[model samples]
Target: MASMLISLSHFCDKHGPRILLVTQAAINGSTGDELLVPTYPTDSYCESCLLHFPKSSINDIRSLKSNIGSQCFVSTQYSSIRYQLLTLIIRRSFSEETMIYDGMPLVFYDDIRGLNLVMGFKLNDENARGNERRYCIIFTIDSTDHTSSMQLLSENWNFITGGFDRMVKYICNSHKQELERQNNVNDEKSNFNLLGKTYLRGNKVKVPRNLAELTHDELLFVRLHKWNSFLLNSCMRSSSE
Candidate 1:
């Protein structure tokens, strides 16, 4: 037990914030592959692997749940992503395990597909089998397809017809340690483009900083701008195809 505790302490100290484990089946084929980014490595496709996000991203994690037009007090648009982003605090470069050590929150984006068959008798339109593509967000505490710890973050009709598939990620023992490491290096240096990637300034690097460089409003604006850009870019690319 003593040795086990030491090992865990080392792991936590070495890798701040828990890791996000994604299933390889979720990333099958081309559609699933595109969801991957630089931080999300695919060395272990069949088995669960870690997902990374900068702790600074928590600035934009200010998501609120809404149930407008929801059938069961859930949600209507299916595009609401409030629940996917958590309120939990993830500190960068923590020496001890924080809230992220016990139950880490993760964010993932993907598409849930299902075949729907319409009755042959109904020929007055809406009778054909509709496309099965849907934008979805699934986050769970454990590494499994279905679990009591699982929560459906978001889902919306894929009107653009782009192929997307399963994506799972959350904070856990597996959360990326490198993100925190890089964040610290950048903070000390105050220079972007560390580790071959651009470190967003202003609100883009919204994580809690010891230096108190940026204000809350500035960070919020940066977060909103980023999300908007990402959403718009995705739609444009898919629509043009």
Candidate 2:
């Protein structure tokens, strides 16, 4: 997978194009190997393409297996139209239609700093017996959403499942960091005893009785309740191990 991702990154660098790729592999089959085969153009442009690729080009790729062997099964799949559609849906749903400027598919949501919601598709292979040519839609909720976006994607199983688990793990780590910062602030507040002290050396100060501090475990609990158990467990495992 790392090599494949690296190859994809290289491909992007050389082509100067950004695309998302999805692959379907047979049980115990190599995802990389299946993607190298030359198959029919299953590239789609929209949700309509996603529904159509299976019926159209998927079979042609599968047929190539006989002549070229499994090497012919390796193919990349991508779709700009589907990405545009999904991006538009997400942007509009999030009430960020204005973010779509200059016909760019990406839109930055100010509420989440460093977060740009992007939608794109890439080339991939469907590992079928004969000619299995298909492309999968790649929907990515990047690390910029301050963790919550990843959580939402993980909980919503309807979204494409690839890479989502890792994304959620990253979000959980970010959440932990934020929680630790808050906890540190609470600790500092609690350390200072300003109760019943109206004036101190010609300076007036006010303070609360106790500051609320949340432990990492407590934050994880909150995340578990709000997100999915599977994601929480994965996060915990990642953090601990």
Candidate 3:
């Protein structure tokens, strides 16, 4: 039994790369909810991928729960025909234990027909802190036949889910580290001190060398002093004249 197991392992190692490994997830898992296709615009094909039948084909694009449309241009007739651009999310998966990473696998129906799919991910960091940041991944699959494309996507469902999950974990950790660095910068800025003091009527105000150190009231005080000095100089010049 041991010898048979060893032989099988060696055989798989030698030939696994040549065979398409299909997992249960790819067979059973659903990519995502199907989006509603608008009928007004006659152009059902995406200008970028040139794939047709938006409602029937593309899977799990954007967050339907949040009212976000699929990343593909075929969301609607107005959207599909007007934009005429293709966007895809390139997703990657990282293994924490192995410290190894793998990118998303491509599903091909016909190599002779040319490229059919493109995917990419985007990070929305504005107004978000660390893990709260939004990461959006888009997959645009294009094919001449809707049935073939859908079947290809279904067969590769496991890869899609695994890639999405791993990428999320990686991004969250990186984002947390970035936030820590930014906080350190703020802490350093807070420790900054002014170089000199401003004296007014025997009272002293510390004049910050860095503009970032200035408060609203301190800024007003500086402006007031400048205006007063300008007025005094003007009066002196008038007297000389």
Candidate with the greatest lDDT versus the true structure: 2
Q: What TM-score would each prediction reach against the true structure?
A: 0.16, 0.22, 0.30
Specify the poorest-scoring 10-residue window by lDDT in model 1.
1-10
lDDT per residue, candidate 1, 23-118, as tens digits? 111111223222233232344321111222223544422111211122111111111221132112112212222212222222322122111100
What's the count of clashing pairs in each model shown? 7, 28, 7
User: How far out, in Å, is residue 37 in model 3?
Assistant: 31
* Residue 192 shift from truth in candidate 1, angstroms: 34
Question: How high a TM-score does candidate 3 get?
Answer: 0.30
Candidate structures ordered by lDDT, highest first: 2, 3, 1
Tens-digit per-residue lDDT, 156-215, candidate 2: 433323334343344345545755686688566655645544333422232111001111
Alpha-carbon shift of residue 152 in model 1 (angstroms): 26
Q: Which segments of model 1 are wrong by more than 4 Å?
A: 1-61, 64-222, 225-236
